[model samples]
Target: KAVALQKLTYLSSLHFAPVASHPLAFPAIELIASPQLPHRRLAYLAASLSLHPASLSLLPLATHQLHKDLSPSTSSAANHHVTALALQLLASPAAAAAPDLPVHLAHDLVPHLSRGSPRAIAAAARVIAASPSAAVPVLFKPLAACLASPDPRASAAAAAAFCELSAPPADAAPFLPLAPDLYNLLTTSRSNWALIKVLKVFARLAPLESRLAARIVDPVCQLLARSAAMSLTFECIRTVLTALPAHDAAVRLAIGKAKEFLAAEDDPNLRYLGLLALGMLGPAYASTLHECRGVIAQSLGDADSNICREALHLMMGLIDDSNVTDIAGMLVSHASKSDPEFANDILGAVLSACGRNVYELVSDFDWYVSLLTDMGRNLHCAQGDEIGRQLVDVGLRVQDARPELVHSSRTLLIDPALLGNHLLCPVLSAAAWVSGEYVNFTKDPVELVEALLQPRISLLPMSVRAVYIQAVLKVITFCCNLYVERLSDSSKEVSVALNGLSMDQTVSGGSDAPIGSSNGQITVPRMMEKDPFSLKSVVHMIN
Candidate 1:
């Protein structure tokens, strides 16, 4: 049977002669409808016919007949198969020829799908979503019921349908009233994936549905304020953050309040996401800088890497050079007593801020050195190998800018195990050679060199290995270039000192002392390193 089907397929392809432009070149409908046929042949026939839009209108009729042929009392497997076929038909672009499906066909299927089976409704929703623009209104009531349905599948389908419908500016009105219901479900339900789908729908619809944003902000804000469960609150936070950019001032104000709530919450993920939102809100609410400053500082102490990463993102957007000194001071003070985890948070935030102001802050060698020294110290002492490596990467970048800071952070470079952490190693290597110079002169000379020659070098793949090699050689060459450029200058001694470090390989490896390794501990910096140039100079000479 399969052989015969394959031959038939070949014959059909051949029948459609070159440049004829005729669509019905084969007997597809008769072969597919043949009952003695194998299901595989039927599936192939369907796929072949799906290339033409005209063949799509025949699908619902065929599918409905298939359903009728099977007794409902039979097991649901057959019903599922037929439904899947219907969904596949609807998802195909070829179905566009019959986009305006008859209302009765859809209405009759709604009751069957609504009776607690999520799969069926999801399939039905796809069909409704694929219908023509004029057919959307006809599908709305059933679509809305799917959203409120207890079945998670139906909820997801409804959300997808809503997202599709809201793509056009004119179709957003019908979705406004559904926002509150979605917000409520997101907060009260255990189904996070469903909420994510719904939030996507809201994001698509919210631009033109300001009234929906206005109506739901209060409740969404309250949910974010109180929910400790990150998964449950994820969409609520994202929706509130996305809505903050709306043209309405009321929506922006609501987001400000939500930002305050996020700052108070201890969840790192929420804090991170919230901080990112606040960054976007910066220009809109510059007057609230003092209030926002505190939130950003608190987020810098979050435990999660991504959360801290987000906090750093927010800080960059919130504070510029005129405000940099104060913001940097706040970060230093907040992270002073913070444990390793908290220090990691601060490091991520600082790195994020650096990306925004690399040109401005990179030149402040002293300050950059001190920050790297602090982060590297924590990285060496802390148990968070992951965070430690990240800090080390950033520390390397600081070293690249101000070799003087290397004395303090240099000890962190040689830990082979630290280099083994794939996530942070590449980042660290990139930072080291970003200036296209070797880290030849610093407080600890061998730190950068050993980082380059570590035994684990062979374990890395060609791509990453190439990256490390290129970055290291570039930094070395860059240092050499800098030396050549400034050799004739009177301040050459200071430049030489800044680029030179002790060659002693005294430290066998990174310090084992646990600084911020504790899962629950949070600490702040007690003091700032005062001799940035000396530390950086030692690292440059060593590398």
Candidate 2:
């Protein structure tokens, strides 16, 4: 069996998930209760792998052996390894997943968290997390003392234990007393890992106790300035960004550190983390973000997508009333040159920013409308639904913007090339609807009619084609109304011209014919020729 341990280990690795009825289950159980030490260890290893935590019925079989292994060795035979393995089993998915740990085992388990072994302490914390009532009165003080232990291993393990306790924040009020201990570890412990865990706990704890924030701010700043470990530095920056925003000095220091992260071009991890940290800053520190816009812009093209995404996120934050026009332009431009996926990401971010709160950041609706149109024309543009919604929404909500909206819509609808792009179908539909609904705003209704009736529109889905046809009808109606109004005006002008002069004057002018059609208004045959919805083009397209 000793020589076969490797085979057993390999076999254990094969079944990653637990199976209650695994063939080796019963042998492993008996091996756990065996007098031989090697058998017990191997049995524990095998059981840990295949034992489902929900198998409470099997508890009777192995509980006694586990309790015996976990219990303090009475003589010189104390094997910390056996005790460690027992704690791990209990801490793992097995007892960790247990809803209510058997109360009897709490006696042996509580001592491990206090002072037994570093490995044991951390594992005990995980197991006790399932039954937290066991930790406060019995193990909390000893665990806190371990955080102050000179050995970094003990302190880190204790910090890990506290990290678990300080989660969800509401339940974390119990760990408020550990803040002074966490702060000590934060300042004195050279272990970056321990410091990170302590910072994490503080991130949750700082809000619960405001005074702890003020007290920990100085040490956190020192760590930010002094620590070369980007992970630890980023944690300190996060602590400041999330928990201590009111402390302006620390926030500035944190933001400065974040900029350094952004500037780490060689390390994409640092760049991504830097962007993440900067994104947490509020508008009050926009100037800092603005100053680092160059680095942020550079991040948008980073080889790593996480960096790109975070870069995009922070870039969107920089958009406001004053700079949105510039920012939107830059993003849309960048999107065009990018691959399709990131291109859409850029388009979406700008759309959300400019369209947020009903385009709250947009002052010049005309410019924004044109921007939407340009985006719709982008080669990789697939943000048609959003673009379409905003287009039609602008036409509906802002009467003054309709003229520009119609102009932009005309640009999109006229492109027969765009009709085949199913992604752009929504955009084209919106364009058609906008052009027709705001036909009065259109300077050239005939051109709009031509665009709406383009033959390639057959490539559009039925729903979109219906919208296109309806738009054509609206354009026709608008043109008809305009023609009638102009006709009435021309007729009135002719009447005035004839009455204003004598018959001889009319006869001398131009063979005694009325000059109404020649005056300047659109005439019938000319209108028909220019209109694509006219009889000839419509018939040709139908045929």
Candidate 3:
């Protein structure tokens, strides 16, 4: 028996080596059937390493050996190793493929949860956790009892199983009674691994149970502060952020700790977690977010794109009416220096944020126009085009409120240097629309017209040239209508003044004579009207 066990150990070791041969399945089987506990343990270990799904012929014998090891009369040491191997086999794809195998294994493992050694109990809990829902109800109460075990491994495994089984709301109700114990473990447990497991279970439960969510916050926040493990701290922060309400004091504590992580930690990943937490809590803590602004803005220039993107998103969320200009300026600066892909992301985020909050942001329209103009002047064509599109959107949205700003936009759009820029299409389109609609408000219509019809207009693309022509036509027509209205009003005033003068003369009994005429015969000044044909000819010539 000792020789066979020795051989099985050698075979198992060989199976793991790079150039190892196939396991001696026949020899392994002989050892598994042995009555000695040491021999059986080694045999099961060897089989687990060597047995493949193709070795279907050994299924019956393996099943028999597992049952023997799990039997109530089995020694504790033997049960520990055997149950672990059994659970491993049950989790294997080959065992899962066998009809009724998981069910039978789950049935045999349920009893061990109460009576087995710690290792065996943990192994049993893991297997049961993976079992179907039909096996959960029968196993839940027994597993819940293991949470009180002095053995931390057993308790942790039991907690993990509870999480798996109680995934559904209806199934989770039975585990509610254990919440206090779980919270205690989360707060007081020495093992980081155990605390993480418990925290996950609570995170999952928190969403369904609001009271439970509130209860877990303080513990989770405490963990975030004290835990040095990056993974653990990240998980704790995420739990608090995702599970708790923003107004909860625990969430505030978690955000405070997370900001520390972002500032103090150099790891990009931890910083990412920190950024995520701050983002979730930023709105609720807006008054205090100024402390994090420099950190987040600096992160926008990080070497890692992931950190940069997260920081960018958080920065965008923090922007408001009072801070749009500063935030927008920062973004434009970053976009100017970033790679094309990241620059695109930055530009896109700015446009989206500003567009959504345009009503609140329009008051800063002049600064925004200048920013867009600078961007167009500095960026490459593709990026510049993106800026131009945003500029056009901003222009159209703000025109009704600040029509005077259109002149500023017009000056930028019609620059000789900017006129030929292919990226200026959207800008020019917006400018044309603004000029045509608000030309009357322009202080110097002739200068505005000159800017619109610079020599560069002839060099513009056909589409833009068409737009320019239409805008000029609208301005000209408006000016003509104003001229005609003013001319008619002036003529009516003159006619009324002349009639009043003549009436005064008749009352004084003096000879009536035209005001400008020296002869006795009364003469009226001829009201010469502008020739409609001549005006039409001039318009036709301009066209």
Better of 2 and 3 by lDDT: 2
- Which 10-residue window in model 1 sums to the lowest lDDT? 521-530
- Candidate-wise lDDT, in order: 0.52, 0.75, 0.65
Cα lDDT of model 3 by residue, 1-543, tens digit = 457546656755666531113345656666776767677666666665545545656667667767766677755875666666666665454444443444555667667677524544554444555464655666566767787777777777676656655665435566678898888777667887778778777877787788887777777777777778977887787787777765367766777778777876557777887887787663556765677888889898889899999998888877888888889888988888898788878877776676674446646676776766666654443555455566556656665534545666567655778776676666666667667767766555545666777888776788877877787787777765654564466776445434433543211113323332233323222231133222222232244
Please provide, for model 1 over 299-360, each residue's C-alpha lDDT reduced to its tens digit, 9 standing for 90 to 100.
56666667666666666566676776667656755566666565556656665565453445
Candidate 3, position 161, lDDT:
59
**If scored against the real structure, what TM-score would every candidate get?**
0.42, 0.84, 0.60
Ordered from best to worst lDDT, the candidate numbers read 2, 3, 1
Model 1, 142: alpha-carbon shift in Å?
A: 1.9
Per-residue CA lDDT of model 2 for 1-543, tens digit only, reads 433543555655785545444545666666776676777777777666655654556667777777887777653464676787777776666666553443446667766756646866765676557666764565566667887787789889888877876776337777887777787787788888999999999988888888898999999999999888888899999999999999999998998888777767688888788888988888788788898898888777777888888888888878889999988998898888888999999999899899989889999999999999999998788899999999988888988888888888888877788887898888888888888788788766666676777778788899999998898778776654554455466676444333433231222222232223233322223334555433323323323
For candidate 1, the TM-score is 0.42
Q: Model 2 reaches what TM-score against the true structure? A: 0.84
By the lDDT metric, which is better: model 1 or model 2? Answer: 2
Q: What is the C-alpha RMSD of each candidate to the true structure, in Å?
A: 15.6, 6.3, 12.4
